[model samples]
Target: METLETLSDKLDTTGDIQSIVRTMKALSAVSIRQYEQAADAVASYAKTIDMGLTAILHDRRAGGLSLPHTGSTDADVAGLIVIGSDRGLCGRYNETVARAAVDCINDRTAVLGVIGARAAARLEAQRHKADRLFLLPGSVAGMTPMVGRVIVEIESWMRERGVETVNVVHNRREGRSRAVPTSSAVLPIASEDLQQLADARWPGPGLPFFRMDRDRLLSWLVRERLFVLLYRALAEALASEHATRLAAMQSAERNIKERREDLTSDYRRKRQETITREMLDVISGFEAVSGSDD
Candidate 1:
């Protein structure tokens, strides 16, 4: 029942919305690429660190030194880091991560650290409180500082809060335009994983050799490993966030286009009806005037 003017105004508004959706889609695509590249670089560095640890562990075993007990058998308090999106419009990106984080707690006394305000709100709604809230980095360049801050917080939790095991929950990019929630232990690098790394075949012709004390070298490598893990996780989470947003924006664009088409069709049909009615009235008047003249 909308008039021509109303239809025109609706079309204009829809056009504006379509423009915004397209802009968001472009930004999401660009962000996904940036974060994916960063994640790839971090993954490469992590492999190198793993190789270093492997060589050091192999040498330590040859020297009859006992391997360091990395994982704690009895963790009195655990720390959980939940990585989520800062902004909405990403279609359950934050909610999925929050649910995974809550599942990870599973009735344990845990210190919770959350990234992104939207995620924190979700957690709060689920009756969980964050011990600390961290803001997500705005760009690739900002990630380093954010990672450093997270590392500092982790160290504090270990040193002052009696937290032993630290776990991270985040969304990882699945296939194109999909994100899956995943969780991994970040601290006390599992001994089994370390053993696997030590058993891995070296790619180079020469075996890795370090000139520093084995324990000291292992400590340095562990720190680097932690850094790489956190950095890579953050990158992956950001990429997944963008991918989800891109998908949502694509859906929005499709709906907007359909709505615009429907509006256009309605406007055209109504205008044609009005013109037909006006022509019919003019013909009738002409016939009446001709009859009167006759």
Candidate 2:
């Protein structure tokens, strides 16, 4: 029979442990959907803008206008953006990004725009100055307006700071800590990346003789392409973030389970020891009475 004391201790441990695991589970569930919505919005731009960019490239070459590449990278004043989790349960999610940020642009002069509080904290710990740190609202819808605002802010920051390049650091994973610390340039766009976009098959076959005013179409195409590139970056970082969170939660859940089992086993052992001692005491007491009567 398990003693009340032992059982109580086991209950306390289980309750405390379960609470943490439950919180982690809820966090994972919430983060997953947020990533999905953000991803969908960002990914859609790839489809909408890629074809138009291709047309622009083809026409530009035929004419003599050299459209500036959106994918090319350069180092002058650098802009670094890191996206990490606001809540922790996902071990190493914030650390991985933070370290990568440190490795790449941890310099004091580099301007930082951090997306999560945890990441911002880490950067601050390392004494990195953050010009802007963003904590995304819960839902992707909340993030929509933020997208443009952030872009504008980053643009303004880069110009004011004389930043020539922008790099983003985030965890990339579908699940597990398999997250790769990724760095993507956000400034002076890479021409090669843009050229790849130019190659994507867009709907409406290239008209054998496409009819349109070249200048108007070209300007519109450039704007759309820029939007697409920025959107893609945000989407990819978010997907990676979700995967990291889920993996961390799952791992935490497992650890709690193991710890609970160990504590329960210990409690049971202690309870049995107490019960056996009580039985021996009773027997000894009866024997002593019998001896006295004799």
Candidate 3:
């Protein structure tokens, strides 16, 4: 049985919480839009890179030049990159990605790299240690440098550590507000995919020609391809994070509204009871006074 004052205090506290939740919801919505736009922009750039790679490969095949092998077939070491969120309040966004990374390990000797603090903590809780930890970019503008750093790390792993295969695990935006955890192999550009690109009809009337060395051109195209893939992953992961947060905040807002309604009802009922008790006391006193006078 709480007093009226206590009930009033609870109502006020709930109102403040509701305001905060609404603010968070608005911020999340804005962030999701920006990140989704970034993802779209990067996707267009990726298509351009793919076209360039296709032209180079087509020319080489026509000239009887051997296609350079992009990925190693007989390597023992593996590299794993896990992208997640640094902040919480996103309903297991970080934990889900960490779990996916763990499942992707598959008993291989892996050099693991983590991109978010919260995600790294989750992985550590599962008795897994990361070889390197990279901070997640706070905004779309900051992602380029972050991706560059990741590329350097990947190169180091392959060049210095003899890592042959590289894989990335993250949550990708599925629909308007849903995220699905997925894993993609980043290294060893799949031969089948390359062949498909090379075999496709050229979009233009004439095939473009380049004077640069074929192998050098292929290497450059491959690097750009990696950058495009990494950038797109980061953008999608960030968008998914904001979508999850928006959903969580919406749920919190609903709960807070219900609680506030219940508290208001209780306050009104108690106040009415108090008023009735006071009225009864006044009436009884008047009756006693009249009897005394008589």
Top-scoring candidate (lDDT): 1
lDDT of 3 by residue, 101-142 (tens): 889876564699989989999999998888899999888899
Q: Order the candidates by lDDT, highest first.
A: 1, 3, 2
* Candidate 2 wrong stretches, greater than 4 Å: 1-7, 26-30, 33-41, 56-64, 68-72, 106-110, 162-164, 193-227, 291-294
lDDT comparison, 2 vs 3, better candidate: 3
Looking at model 1, the pairs that clash are none
**Model 2 accuracy (lDDT, Cα):** 0.69
- lDDT of each residue in 126-173, candidate 2, tens digit only: 987567878755655666565676677776875587766767777766
lDDT of 1 at 28: 90
| Candidate 1 accuracy as lDDT | 0.89
For residue 283, what is the lDDT in candidate 2?
100
- TM-score between candidate 1 and the true structure: 0.90
State the lDDT at 226 in candidate 3. 89
| Count of clashes in candidate 2 | 8
Better of 1 and 2 by TM-score: 1
TM-score of each model, in listed order: 0.90, 0.76, 0.92
Worst lDDT run of 10 residues, candidate 1, spans: 65-74
Q: How close is candidate 3 to the true structure, as a TM-score?
A: 0.92
